[model samples]
Target chain A: MPQQRVVRTIIIADQQGLHLRQAVECAQAAGRYQSQIILVSGERRAENCRSPFEILQLGAGYGAAVTIEATGPDAEQAVEEIAAILSRQTSH
Target chain B: MEIKRGVAVSPGVAIGPAWVLDTEEVRIGERFIATGTYPEEIERFDRAVQAAANEARQIQKTVSERLGEQYGAIFGAHAALIEDPNLRQEVAAQIRDHSFTAEYALSRVIRRRAKILAGLNDRILADRQSDLFDIEKRLLRQLVGQRQAQLQKLSEAAILLAHDLAPSETAQLDRQHVLAFATEAGGRTSHTAIVANALGIPAVVGLGPFLTDVSGGDLVIVDGNRGLLILDPDAETLERYRQAQAAQAGHERELIELRDLPAITRDGVRILLLGNIEFPEEAAQILERGADGVGLYRTEFLYLGRKEDPTEQEHFQAYLKVLRQLPGKPIVIRTLDIGADKFRSAVEPPAQERNPFLGVRSLRLCLHNKSLFRVQLRAILRASAFGDVRIMFPMVSTLAELREAKLLLHDVMDELNEEQVPFNPQIPVGTMIEVPSAALIADLLAKEVNFFSIGTNDLIQYVLAADRTNENVAYLYNASDPAVLRLIEQVVRAAERHGIPVNVCGEMGAEPMYAFVLIGLGLRQLSTPPSAIPELKRLIRSITVEEARRAAQAALQMESAQDITNYLRDQIRRILPEALAV
Candidate 1:
């Protein structure tokens, strides 16, 4: 096997849903490592933590669970980091 | 490699891969639904439509993970708009009755009723942001479609290249990856440039339509310091940027040489040199550039771009953050100087006037609305306990107005004390010497205030009756004009007679060319952006009091403003060519 990365689910339970501040925190955390971060929800998937709008395109509303996958030297770290961001309430 | 050029919005240079943040891809998804399709098609359309919206939200969440909540919020807001009852019903009705897919149904309603969705109270309707949506709604329908054009996400620590970007889209940028930005479309003071300055990102904007010449990920060199853009860099171009960067670094290294050096003249007169900052992060630069303190912390930014008024606690926390960073530095916070050209969502809707530039605004508005001023005053008074805090009011036209503002500050301070809030009771309050009436009666106004900071930007505009934005009157916006200098000289003398200190925090002060002239005019304090500190420090060190005083005395004899400008230009051109060139 070449390489494998684990994908886990994250629920956007916050009413504000996945907003920009969380995106920034998540991206910064993911950026700390050398990993390819990816987010998959339903049949659609994208680069997990990219720009704020890209994350919103997944349209994972309240009560929706999102799959987050990271692969690279620091895959596990990236997943943990993004998960933490998605867990917080919107800081408005 | 590709190359382009534009107006330099901010300064600094860094090279990296390209990360273009575009919002076009966050549009309605596609679905194939016939007008006369089977009954089952309508249900499928509804399901697809819901899924598309769901997909958009998930994408927003994922990107927010990468970028931040700002981008997440924008999409979140859009997501909410779609979920609005009227809109949801309209889209659902269109899907069922017109037999259209959900994405198609939503897009139709959005396109046809863009005005309704983008009214002053509309979900898409925002003051500064409305204009961007107006442009994007049109462009999104034409150039972009869901899943057609790919939105790029570059590795961290990369420069951004783009033809153009909306202000909100630009601001939501993760500045870490985006080192420098060069745009195809923008003006000198475009929103993109404004946000770039706020983000402290080195940006070159307003390159016109020429950005189309460059494509994706071409090796680009944005010399924002010189407003030059080089593409397909040859060895010489690369070496030039490297050398220029090294020399710039050397210049900064020399600036650090002034870290502990006092801003003193040959005559041994010492002056406080401070920096004007717009954001909290800029506090770091204030220290790095060796500013004695912050002369003018424009709190207008706190009210700008924000959807709601900043709570007193929020403002206190921000002020505390900056004050803690620069413990002993005097931070003169100019309270919410919005008006004349700025507006915030929290502000009352401005009545359409014949001439807004001369309309009732700034201090006039704040005085009229006591609650607005009180919230800010409470925040300031609360934060004062932490550091050397001072308050300066803008657009004060009379002594009574100064008294009124001071009274409001007292009320806020009393409340803070009663509420057991710790604050600096003896905090000095000042008024901007901008209104001509205030300058003419400087003696009376100075009596009511603790200090004065001449807002030369507006002072010149009001005194000369010259709108700086008007091209024809721009010629009158000269900072070195005799009329303006004379007013400043008068104000300085009045402040001296009253035993109060006066400082200049306008662009005129920031301009290194007038560093000596202002000091010679009895100004012991000059607050400018830190970028100009190195050059200003050079001018301050180079001149003797004897020379500056004589020049000021001679220049005062000139009658016309142009004569004063020409005189200062020639005088500085003769000496301190480096500062002038910079």
Candidate 2:
């Protein structure tokens, strides 16, 4: 049986917005593992935050609180990495 | 032996002795009957294949350690293929009976594998040029070790005329000696083509089959603008090309001298000829070339060079460096222009993207990534306090988007106020009228944004529904097309109604011939490359806006886009008869 992990992360910075670089980082880190990653906004569960194009497609604006859940090998690692990405609220 | 004829890619005339690069040859082993037992021959062949595999692995490691994992992976894959169990058995059978050298044996395998990867490299490279550079880097390492390779011994300032250049080899090219580049294997949209364009070096590719016949030093001339390659030209043709080159040199000297002169017309009509630049260092070069100010500073590169979002401080320093150089000149900075097509990050990347250029890029990407966009806005606004600076948004197609973007700009201002950072409160924010919706409703969008700069690159592409790279439709991608012309007119008229200044910043503005027409069409402020200033100044000093307006009206009345393009191209041909054909 695989361990499950859930992390609540609030997008703090509203000004710069969650950009392509951040989304790319999130997607790239998550894509490396075989974890089933899902970004949940209230009742909506956004599938696989590992693709920047998909993240942009979601139209997830700034200051939005989204829950991240990961399950599989390296699930805890993926959730923590994505949470850290959101905490910064910006990418270079 | 001495050779003088070759396309001038980098543009320093050199007369150097012939140095031929190693010509990759196709090898086929001749079958010879086995003198000994078959199993013994098979064993010997297996050992030879293993040796080749070991050699490949070492090369892969060296490449990976020197370059990166991405480059190393390419050779590693090739090594795997070379050592594949099936291939080893097949090639081993041929070599033992035929008694061929390792070079011949390797070529035989490569020829069969070529059919699979055949043209996929170019297709993949067209979508992402950086990927092709990865391949080119690996090939350069492989070539360096080859015994017969002749490029190692080349003397200074020579023109490199090859069949085609892999990305690694292109990266390794010594600009000091390579005057120009021409190849038989690359198209206008190929990796080599973009590199040539960026370097501003003259190059022509895709002159297929001609690569096989030319020696190392055959007098070759590359006309990049027209995609023409002349080989073995007689004395008369050489003299004509040399004269053309000389005149271009003279023209450049004239621009340098004009650097100190004010960019004014004969009637003393003061026009602002600003430089559209990328790097902050390039801004210095632009000023040195006599630009009035920095008209278009592409902010995308700040985000592009690094894997992370640039810190507000990082962005400020880069902007300040340029501002310090030109204290009085206005710097119009466009926000980050990245999307699926031009991203520089490593993770959850814009993967397996399709049509990134037309899809989520520029302003659309900005909206999706608000946090990233806000930081840039704050920095640009902060930088404005140091000198005259204006912020512009690219690919703005909607009034709603413009409204939202402005509000975001305001939000940044609020943060700066809280942080007690000093910045200009009245800094003007502008939107580019590159899309049809923005141009059509320019009056409305112009109200929200401070000004409009007509980005004809995107404007022409969208209006004509033609990708400039697409060979089938590239002929249709004309800015002079009546549809595009009408859009430009609409945007300019709308800007006038609101008293907002409108400018042009496309390749069209850079050409001296098109400068006349753009001026006549009512674009008073023009931003182009620094090198184009003197010629444009000379052109402006010669023609009145009235003559240009007359030409524009006739151009719009032409039936087909090609007709209009031809008419405009010909009109400019007469104005500056020796300008590049494009």
Candidate 3:
């Protein structure tokens, strides 16, 4: 069977954008799934969802739209979790 | 004689060599390397990255352990940014592609990243540029084989002038050499300011771009008392500051001498000098400075920086710590003075009020949250058995509110009695005379409480209809205002009639000059910061109560606040010239 792929466009709603702590949270949440997750915004793409540095390099600040893409058996769950983390307007 | 004004955090004056701390940037020009030396450049960059990572980790660990996990996490963020695979790859690619020096390559790559973060147009995102800059500098220092200027190890005494010092940097400040500090950024309650205060270093912050106007080794005067930084003063000004500095030293010596002496005025009027403290640990400083006891131990600090409401055991432990610290000394523990600026995350106040100052806060909030209030009261009562402890309720406006608070205290006492916990049954209860309503009805209010502590900071601001924190209306918020003095006068008279001891425990009482007026107003007990005790005690001992009484009478008759202020200043200068000098 072809690898299942899930993609979702989500707006970064946190006031601090994809800063270190938030990036770490996203990375931790993404690590729980078996799927490979990637975040993309404009010309920038962070394929290493578990790398906070890569997430920060995306520069996806407040109001910036980013695409969360996942490919695996649990692709749908991975994309939903990562997308929810990015979309939530909270620090904790 | 250029004077830059900032917010005064710690009070004192310092005239010394200026030490400009421009750590944000290191002037490093691009240097070309031979094409064959690309391998060497990459190796150097790799080493620097490793060293920087190690340093970041150490900083994170030490800071987290010392301060808190939240604060220590910043260094972890820095380490993560530094160890970014993309950043390392970009620098290495630059070193190979252009035969550029490692420092230059790293600088360029980091600068580009910072630019990208800045261009995001989000304020919080834009701040990340500083993180980028900090990491870049850390790497560059490691690569260049140079240690970052150690602020903790200054060669000589100097006034530290910086845009700002982080809490970590401020914590490591050499108390012996850095006579004082002035920064371009920070508020009175910022971590740096708080550390500065705790370390007893006079500091002024919020002077914009002070580093730009000052050079290292130039004569600078940091008037922390007035929040003024004078750069390269004229000879006359230098002479003036020198005398002031000398006077400060002399005044300190004089006050230290009087530390073992009682704070009694001439003609045998004994005044009690107490320390207003937040943390129990500060009780030592209070005792060191010769404070008779803790006048006000704000219990609100226990509520801060925690998600969960402090348990009864936690509150009991905290009160126990303060009580044990000052064994037999009187310690007035104000119960949960939260709301109207002081708040805890544990207690969710209703959606932001249109007027929070007048909204449900302080005693009102406590009344609503009976469970929380009861826990605090139980702790206070339990701790009172250990030492001389007094329970004070803050922001009590009405007789009904006071009665309600007392009724709840009675309930807590009954609960403790049923539990068979040993507590001081007669733990002298008091109410802070801060509200205008409380002050106006002091005669009736005085009948209920054991003593009265005039919280003049709020009383003056409230009575004048001005928010002291609001810069625009700050001019109207003067304790010397005739109206404020009259209200204070009313409370003092009421307390006198009831034969209840009244103390002034506010910013007004902290001022040696203003304290003299309070003395004249029949406030025999003054509670201020531990740092101000010596100076206040000296002023008390220098003047007679009769003299302060005359000044108070004249001040009350004055029409304007400015007139009253000027009159008091002149009177203080005449009676205690050394008091004005310090």
Candidate 4:
């Protein structure tokens, strides 16, 4: 069977953008799923959603559009969880 | 013996052995490893990463338990980064593919990542570049087998000497064993200085590069009062410092004896002494110092040093903390007084103001961001229900701004009323007369507010057009200047005419000489630091209002700020000869 793929685009709404703390949170959430997650912002693509450095290098500042794509058995759950973490408006 | 000068941030003297903190830079011996040794290098890298992760977790546990969960969370984040599978993979790949040494591979990967972060346009993200470097140092320490100079595990009391201290290291400082600290780099407003002040530890910063001149276990004297770091003091100098230390203690004891006494003049005029505190935890110290109440509860701390603007609930909790601590006492909650630059995360991209002091700051920033202003007002109103909470707006240079702020407060009050929130609807509103325009038109402002609080620190700076922090022009920023005195007198006269009480809630009120002038200029209330209340009360108790008024009248007639300052000093010296010793 072909691997299931899930994709969703969300705007970074956090006041401080997708900062280190938020990046850490997103990576932690992505690490839980057995799926390959990719975060695309503008022309840059973070190949490893589980890597905070890759996610941070995306430079997904406030209001920047980010597309989360996942491919695996739990692709849908991975994308949703990663999107939820990135779209949080408050730091806490 | 060598003497070095720096900026004195926290007061008091500390004499102890020096504990030199090593810089974070790690030396990597070899950059590359032989192809045959690549596998061994990878194993070493893995072990180092594990050790660094363990260290981070250990710090997190100790800091979380000692400081708070929030501070502990910083280390937890560090641990997560240290144990990052991606970071480990990159380091291992560097070692295997390039045949790089473990130390070199870790440094190369971390530095590249840090450079990426540093190059980012976002300041908040760019600031985290240091954290990456910190992690690199931690891992490198493990790989190099270098023992960390653990400040938290100091066995004996010592004066910490360092080129600079990281925020994490400063937070983990064991106050019992860390007597005081002096650094070769830092300013008055640095995080290290603020932490030292909060911990009541003597600290001097920005002493230039003198770490090489001294070694660990060298006896040192940190004269925080004079911003001097005396390394290997001579016997004569040491004896003088010992006497000074004893004198300081004796002086404090003498002031503590006057805590219960009212700030009443010899001629029977009672003066209200209050405290200016930044944190809610300081409310108890104000009461202990025998202050009447809190005159200026600076609310900016809630908005500063945080990732986001404090929620309305957070603001309410902070105000409620102070209120619960000082029941029935008047607490003046000054609204947000920070510049727009500070809220760059919440607001638009920073425009890099050439002069932030004159830019959209304080009340102006609040007016531009009404939602932010309303959140604070709502919180203040909510907390007003608990105690005698009076709202004060800072940097109101114009009548329109004051009217607009008051209008917003009314709107917030109405909203609270609709929501059936119990609050003091009749809560007093006041304006900080710091701007020269506010002082010039004090009568107009007095009519709009329940009271007036003369903030002489900014008033002197504005009137003289001098930056107090700039050493070159700091002399011009004198409270004893006739221009400043005239403004205070005008504001006082205006408040008197309008039948409103005036309070001086600036550093000017803390000094005996200045307090004499302020009291003579007809200010019945003075708010100063909690530590200053007893001394100010002592000064108040030593002189008569008649004498103070006469001295003030003479000082106002003087020509230069220097002349007026000398005149006031002479008057104060005669009134309280013991004040000179302090």
Which model scores highest in lDDT? 4
**Against the true structure, what is each candidate's TM-score?**
0.66, 0.63, 0.70, 0.71
Worst 10 residues of 2 chain B by lDDT: B127-136
| Candidate 3 chain A: worst-modelled 10 consecutive residues by lDDT | A83-92
What lDDT does the true structure give each of the candidates?
Answer: 0.69, 0.66, 0.82, 0.84
Better of 2 and 4 by DockQ: 4
Listed models, DockQ each: 0.02, 0.03, 0.18, 0.21
Report the C-alpha lDDT of model 1 over B1-582, residue by residue, as the tens digit.
Answer: 445666888888765555544534355665546766635644554454455445447645864554443444454444433333344456567776866665566567655554432342412122223323423343243323334232235456766766676554565577666778877666554556665776778888767665455555766777777676676678877887788788778977887897778888777877788899877767888888888999999887576534478898888887888899999989999988776323433456444344656776788878877887798899888888888999899888887888889888888878877899898889999999888889999999888889999988889998889987669889878877888888999999999999999999888887655776888788889888888786777778777877888888878898876676677777777777655442
- Show the colliding residue pairs in model 3: B520-B548
Q: Write the per-residue lDDT of candidate 3 for residues B221-268, one digit (tens) a residue.
A: 998899999998999988988998887788678888889899889879
State which candidate has the highest TM-score. 4
Task: Give the poorly placed runs of model 3, Cα more than 4 Å off.
Answer: A1-92, B1-132, B135-167, B177-245, B340-349
User: How far out, in Å, is residue B44 in model 4?
Assistant: 7.2
Q: Identify the runs in model 2 with alpha carbons over 4 angstroms from their true place.
A: A1-92, B1-16, B21-156, B159-174, B180-241, B255-257, B303-307, B324-327, B338-361, B398-400, B461-477, B511-513, B550-582
Q: What are the runs in model 1 whose C-alpha is more than 4 Å off?
A: A1-92, B1-220, B223-231, B235-238, B279-281, B301-311, B340-359, B408-422
- Residue-level lDDT tens digits of model 4 in B1-582: 999999998899989899988764566755788778888888888888889989988887876666545456677778788878889898889888888888888888888887887677766666566577668878888988997756777888999998876556776788899888898877764445655776678989889999999999999999999999999999999999999999999998988889998999999999999999987778888888999999999987687544468899999999999999999899999999876545443544333455767998899988988988899999999999999999999999999999999999999989998999999999999999999999989999988999999888888888999998779999888888888898899999999999999999999899888998888988899999998899899999988899888878887788888898888888878878889622
DockQ of 3: 0.18
